[model samples]
Target chain A: MSDHLPSTARKPGLTSSAPSVVAAELDPPTPRKRKAPGPRHEDKRVAILRTAAQLFADNGYEATSLDKIADQLGMHKATLYHYVSNKESILYQCLVLSFGNLDAVMSEMEDRSVPPLQRLRQFAHSLALAQNNVFGRCLVLVGSRPLDMMPGGEIRQFQRRLDETVRALIVEGIADGSIKPCHPGLVSSMLFGSLNWVPRWYQEGGKLSIEQVVDSFMDVLTSGIAAPRR
Target chain B: MSDHLPSTARKPGLTSSAPSVVAAELDPPTPRKRKAPGPRHEDKRVAILRTAAQLFADNGYEATSLDKIADQLGMHKATLYHYVSNKESILYQCLVLSFGNLDAVMSEMEDRSVPPLQRLRQFAHSLALAQNNVFGRCLVLVGSRPLDMMPGGEIRQFQRRLDETVRALIVEGIADGSIKPCHPGLVSSMLFGSLNWVPRWYQEGGKLSIEQVVDSFMDVLTSGIAAPRR
Candidate 1:
């Protein structure tokens, strides 16, 4: 979804009194064009996505339909189509955004100045917070099972890239002697498994903040539950 | 579904030629009766459940139907009703069995003479292995979302009991000084989250055995991945 409005149109001055007089002097007033796609358009699209993701997470993917989403959004079915093509497309976008959050965390890891252990902790904190969002919860609860036959295969690619990134981080940690020697693949599975399961039990305004949960998990993951050997 | 066949009917001797002569001497021969529900009936019921679980895990519970399960098992759809009332019943049974496995682990933990940390490790190992089974995978993948409104509320109760058991173990470990002091709730969530996620990535005949996977998880849980402080 592209918005081709001029960059000058986005300036706050255009909507204020002083800039309008200057524009009037510059050129004769003409019939105003229909409202262009702008911030409001993007906001509405995000609203539709958020509503759809919540429904999909609360009710399952198979049980949630576009009509229900439209009803929830108080938009006509036809009007809803202007924002999202279909239910599957909404789900696809939600997953894309969900994985995009993880991808951003991985991108931040490219700054090698941070030690692997700290980078891993930062990644865990970011991932836990991301998964607390509606789209992230939808990604975990509804999952890609419904989209197995969907054409793009982008979901699978995102999954593979995520797996590789986690494993690579663990390997780096091991190499730098920050992480204990272990099976990177298995350790990554445990890490992802623990973090991904967070959505199933995590409550937004519950007792613990996302930071606290991540901190507890990181503590357990680093120091472990067992008492130190005498 | 109960099988009320006589205990004598279960004896292997009754199926053997030598036992038939002893039975003839014991009583006069009469008209043969219809075959009773014995080992074969139990075997068939287990077969139906296993087939249904596989279908539910692979195709999803919403997408899977009793007819499809029958087709996969090469049995008439009506015949499936004899073993399970409907798809919901099959899912309930699968969850019952899955939770039953966890309950058994908790029961094993009742032996308090073993230190709490050792008991926690045993619980982790048992949980990971249970999740590797088809029924366990069904519980994780298909879930109770489909049967949420089912009348009995057994599933919810089972989940609560499981949460309490894990938390209790963590508390006990902390009291005994076998485990590091931490928030039992957060630690238990992390523990269950990690173990429950096994069904997602674990392949039965993949590179690692269930024991190996469990061992790795136990290692991570006990010692963690961070290298020891100098």
Candidate 2:
């Protein structure tokens, strides 16, 4: 029963041989896959991406090679070309996955009837949760370089769409006097810079749970910590 | 005379070849040599880095190459290698120059009698300034990957040291009643995160100047845009 669950959420499996992107997908060895004679092709593809992400993250992207990725995955190097056309392809896929997932979560929150502040809190939690899977690791480890190679132009547009939504929320909050009248860009800069950069310092066993991490940031940002400047 | 002022900082007519670090000491244009070389070698190095930073920032790091860097510089492939060992070294040098200069500015502020908030302001300027210079472009282009082989240990330690200093100042501000008592880590996280990440979107000659960029961030951070609650 436990097999279906993603192994660990935020960051427990350092040496468990789970590549950052594919490890979570491996849970619960599903019932249908056992009949095939070949190794699970989907799983292998995920594994390749997982391996590629690690190599890309560990060694700078240009330094990582397909042979090395295949060697690490214990397969012929050419085998991976079937799943991904180039090393860069894996990076692009990982980013699309991360950004796509993030936008979906935030959009889902926007549909709720809650106040903008409540919505933000929900967002902070949802944002934290996305990192539990493979896509989150890729986002942090690789940074923001992949957006350039994208042919879809979807990634940037997606981000802009999301930013507009957040800005609208902020503007609403300001107009009604429900929250602070902060610059949308500044609030966003702080929120994202702190959240995006968290993966760098976050350890699985840090005193704070991911929830606490979100709360710590929200508390300061929403309600300035000084005793009301009186 | 003003045209020569920047040259006074380096050699007057030396070709601004992309100097490679392969033979670090032997290849370096010494202080005198660099001065005479003036706007040539350093300018080329700066130009190459400017082009690379935008490319690296636009595309992820792995997708960029020395050959690509040379192409952007309108130079031949072999010529690019003469400036650095490999793409990773370029990334490293880019970051090191940025970080190294930031360290100098922070220390200079440290010795001054400025208040803690003012000190923070100075630090912000120092960092933001680098984002526009030959050094900052290097740092911002490859800033997040500390464990990257090129700058590896030294780079990470330097970042940590700076982070700690920022944290300490935030704590001091809180304790002295100059600033509110927010989570020190989160404060530093938000402040440093936003400050360091500025290069991701800022462009010179854009609508906002560097000072304007710094002001935009500082304005929101120093004073909450939220109204004083009853």
Can you list each candidate's DockQ?
0.41, 0.30
Q: lDDT by residue for model 2 over A30-52, one digit each (tens)?
A: 45665432446666666677667
Clashing pairs in model 1? none
Candidate 1 local Cα displacement, residue A4, angstroms: 21
* Candidate 1 lDDT, A1-230, residue by residue in tens: 11222223222212212222222222223358655455565567777878888999998899898999999999999999886677776786666555534655677777779977677789888777767788778988888877776655666776676668778888887776677778888877878888888888888788988899898888877664233544
What candidate 1 gets wrong by more than 4 Å, as runs, is A1-37, A224-230, B1-37, B224-230
Which stretches of model 2 miss by more than 4 angstroms?
A1-48, A77-89, A99-104, A143-150, A224-230, B1-92, B108-113, B144-147, B150-152, B224-230
- Report the C-alpha lDDT of model 1 over B1-230, residue by residue, as the tens digit: 11222223222212212212222222223358755445555567767777888889888998898889999989999888876677776776666555434655677777889877677788877777666677778888887888876655566676676677778877887676667778888877877787888887777787898888878777877665233544
Question: Could you list the iRMS of every candidate?
Answer: 2.7, 3.4
| Backbone clash numbers for all candidates listed | 0, 24
Tell me each candidate's TM-score.
Answer: 0.81, 0.71
Positional deviation of residue B159's Cα in model 2 after best superposition, in angstroms: 2.1
List A-chain TM-scores for all predictions: 0.78, 0.73
